[model samples]
Target: MILITGATGHIGAAVLDQLLKITDPGEVAGLVRDEAKAAHLKAQGVQLRVGDYRDPASLERAMQGVRKVLLVSGGADEDGLQQHYNVVDAAKKAGVACLAYTGRALQNPATLANELMVRHFQTEEYIRASGVPYILFRNILYMDTLPQFVGPQVFERGIQLPAGQGRVAFALRQEMGEAIANVLADSRCDNRIFTFTGAATYSFADVATALSELSARPVVYTPIEQPAFAARLHAQSLPEAVIQRISGFLTDIKNGQEATVSTDLADALGRTPASLQEGLPTIFKL
Candidate 1:
């Protein structure tokens, strides 16, 4: 049996959908805190297990009889690392065949300075040392999240970020989920890492051009300083912590951390993942 955490979320639901096609729905279980929230999954014949990353006992219960488990990354608080350790510990105790994890894509992750980015690498280290067969899907940023950076009035306010000219190999979230499910269904358990990415790399300037074409109006790209960017977010009433987290992400992009492109995503899905041009329309509702 295979279990996917955060089954009710966008990526988790996408994985479950693809997994159901290649494997029996009865062989799948969704780890969710409240079973009522996953009634839709249950309707699709997926078993729902009540669990929480912070609750080790709940994870143990969810790991029961599961051969493979997918750990979807989450948590914004400082306790997040401990939560991930709980999941890994529970999976190890259950003696699961494999433990799959969704992490960030970076060549030198150990050199990362961001708080959350460091946690990701730390989690990867803990998983490797746990002595369990594992697959690390080091995913890039999702194109779906581009809408947040673009805001509601791109034509008028234009585009502004601290990312500078840095590019990202942004993959579609749904395709990433599909690729992940493809691996989870396989029984190989190679204990490998896959650079989950899109077909091409694109910068924010390219984003402006795309929006200009879609909106039939001039859309400009303005690279702002990190402090100014944070001020803008603060003007929108964003909390200080969220502002810092977002700024860290922009800093990483500006540092060229997400610039690398890889065909692993296409290889995993047995087809080329959607390019930015093809995916932008759907993501921005154009």
Candidate 2:
């Protein structure tokens, strides 16, 4: 049986849905912390196994009779690295034959100034040292995030960010989840690293242009310095941690760490990945 951690989350939930369509529901097990939240999945015939990445004993219990596992990275917290360590150690001890993890698409996340990327690098190292057969999916920024980053605000007040002319190869979350499901099912995918991204790339300027055309509203992109952007966020009463993360992300984008375009996603899913223009309507509810 295959066990997928964080199965109630967006990516994990989509992965489960795709897996069910391609394979028997009996062959899949979802690691859920709250049974109440997973009642829908249980009703769909997926076996619900209670497990928490912070709890080693619960992970071991969930890993019983499991041959393969997908370790979806933990949420946006400070304990992500330690939580990944706990899951990797338990999976190794359970003698899991194949292990897969979702990580950032940056070639060297540790070298970047971003805290989140550094944690991903640390988790990757820990998984390598665990001696378990593994595959790493380096995922790009989600197109879904565009709604939160630059959306209706652009139509009203215009868009502003620390990113310069830098571009991002954004992929839809659902497509990435489908690719993950395909990789986990194919034994040949073991021990390989894949980068999942859209077929095209776009910059903030390009996004503004697209919105202006689609919405028939004049949207403009204003490039601002990193410190000034942080100050603006602070004025809005955003937490310091959030301001730091957003600023660090803009720095990475400007450094070209997020502009990587790859064909691996199409190869895995046997089709072309959706572009930003194709996914914008759904993301912005247009």
Could you estimate the TM-score for every candidate? 0.97, 0.97
lDDT agreement with native, every candidate: 0.90, 0.87
> Model 2 scores what on Cα lDDT?
0.87
Q: Which ten residues in a row have the lowest lDDT in candidate 2?
A: 107-116
Q: For residues 92-205, what per-residue lDDT tens digits would candidate 1 score against the true structure?
A: 998988999999997577555456888888899999999999999999999999988778888788999999998899899999999999989988898999999887888999
For this target, which candidate reaches the highest lDDT against the unseen true structure?
1
lDDT string for model 2 (104-212, tens) is 8875565586777887778888888888989999999888888777744678988898889888998999999999998888766358899998888889998888888
**Model 2: residues with Cα > 4 Å off, grouped in runs:** none
